[model samples]
Target: MAGHSKWANIQHRKGRQDEKRQRVWTRVSREIMVAARTGGGDPGANPRLRLAIEKAKAANMPLTNVNHAIAKATGTLEGMSYEEVRYEGYGIGGAAIIVDCMTDNKVRTVAEVRHAFLKHGGNMGTEGSVAFQFKHCGQLIFAPGTSEDRVMEVALEAGAEDVITDDDGAIEVLTAFADFESVKKALEAAGLTAEVANVTMRADNSIELTGDDAERMQKLLDVLEDLDDTQDLFHNAAL
Candidate 1:
C-alpha cells in the first residue's frame, strides 16, 4: 500500500473526534456537490454521485442537507462555483506530494498552497512534475473484523485489481477507477462493509523519512488537510 493509504488508515483508526467531524463533513459535501454537478444528480446513473451519497450517509449527514447539495448542483438553488485543481510538489525528504483542491478563487488557493509548502520545508512544482510518480486507483478500506479471504473472493469476482491485508486487520481492496462502483456493490452484496470507498492517487514509489524530517512532513500534511479548500492530499512519504 502507498503511504497516503496507510496514513488514511491511521487517521481512521484514531476515529473522529468532535472537532474534526465538522471539517470533514464540509469537505465531503463539496465532493458530493461536484460529483452531482459533473455526472448529474441521479445516483443510479452517476457512480461518483452514488459513492458520495454513501459517504454522506456514513458520516450521518442529514437527508435534508444531502438533498440541498444535490439541488445546488442541479441548479435548483444557487451555489458557489468551484473548480477542481491539482498541485504537485516535494516535501521534506524529497517525498513526492500531490494535492487535490476545490476552490472558488484559484489565485488565492494557489498562493496559500505555495505558502504552506514554503513554510513546511517544501516547494511546489509544475503540474506534471510529481504527478508522474503516482497512479490513480480506486481504494476501498474495510473495518477490522472483515474476513480477508471472503473480501478477496468478492472483490476479485467484481474485477478488483488487488486486495491487501494489513497487520492491523484492515483490508484494502484496489480496483481500476472504472470498476470501483461494481466492486463496491459486490462487497456490499456479500455482506462486507467498507469503511472508506473512493478513487484516490496511489504513489508509485515512496521516500523513507525518520526523526525530524518525518515529524515535519506530518505537520505539513496536517496543515494542508486542514484547509477548507483542499479536498485530497497524496504523498510518497514512507512512514
Candidate 2:
C-alpha cells in the first residue's frame, strides 16, 4: 500500500484548490443523491445519507445543492436514477485495478471502461478476477499537525483497528466497516477532522513499478479517474 499512500500524499500536497472544485462538487452531489435514494433522505435516520452529507460539507458543497439532491432522491423532484457498478482489471506490471461507478447505462459504462484499460496497456477482467486481492475497509485520513497519539487514543476507543502514520505526516485510521461512522463521529466530536474519510477497497498486496512502467501506470490511473462515470479507482501499484 506504499504506492497508494504516496499517491494520496501527492494529492494532499496538491490541495483541493488545484483540482476543478466544480467537478468534485458534481461527484459529491451524485453520491449524496444516490445515498439518499437508497437509504432515505433524512440524515438523522439514514447512516449512509449522513455520511454523504458529511463528505459534501467537507468539500464545501453548497447547502442548497445538497438539500435539492435529497429532495430529488425522495421523489420531491425528478433526478437521474443511477446504478452502481464495479469493474475489475489488471494494469501495467500486473497491478490489480478496480473501478467503481454510478451510471444510468451499464452497456456504455462497461464499453468505455474496457476501452480505457485496453488503451492503456491494461485489460478488463471477469468479476472477482482481481477483487479477491482487495479488502473493503473504512479509511480516515487526518491532516498534518494532528497529534497521532491523541488521534489513536480516540480512534482505538471508538473501535478503530489500526492507526498508521504516513511518510508525509498524515495520520490514517483504519476501522472495521461497521465501526466507521462511530469512529468518525468520535474524532469529529474531539475536533479532529479527517481530510478523507470513506469506505474503500485496500489492496491486500502491491506490485512495485519504476521508470516507464510507473509513468504509464500514473497516466492510466489518471485517465480512469477523469471518466465522469468513474467514482473510485483502486490499484495495487506500489508507487
TM-score of each predicted structure versus truth: 0.90, 0.90
Worst 10 residues of 2 by lDDT: 1-10
lDDT of 1 at 22: 74
Write model 1 residue lDDT over 1-239, tens digit each, in one string: 42233635356423742357777677778888999899999998998888888877877888888888899888999998787999989899789988899999999999989999999999999999999888899998886678888998999999999998865677889999999888988999999978777888987677878799988998888787767788888888866
Q: Which has the greatest lDDT?
A: 2
Deviating ranges (above 4 Å) for candidate 1: 1-9, 12-18, 143-145, 167-169
Question: How does model 2 score by TM-score?
Answer: 0.90
> Which pairs of residues collide in model 1?
none
- For model 2, the superposed segments whose C-alpha errors exceed 4 Å read 1-18
Report the Cα lDDT for residue 118, model 1.
95
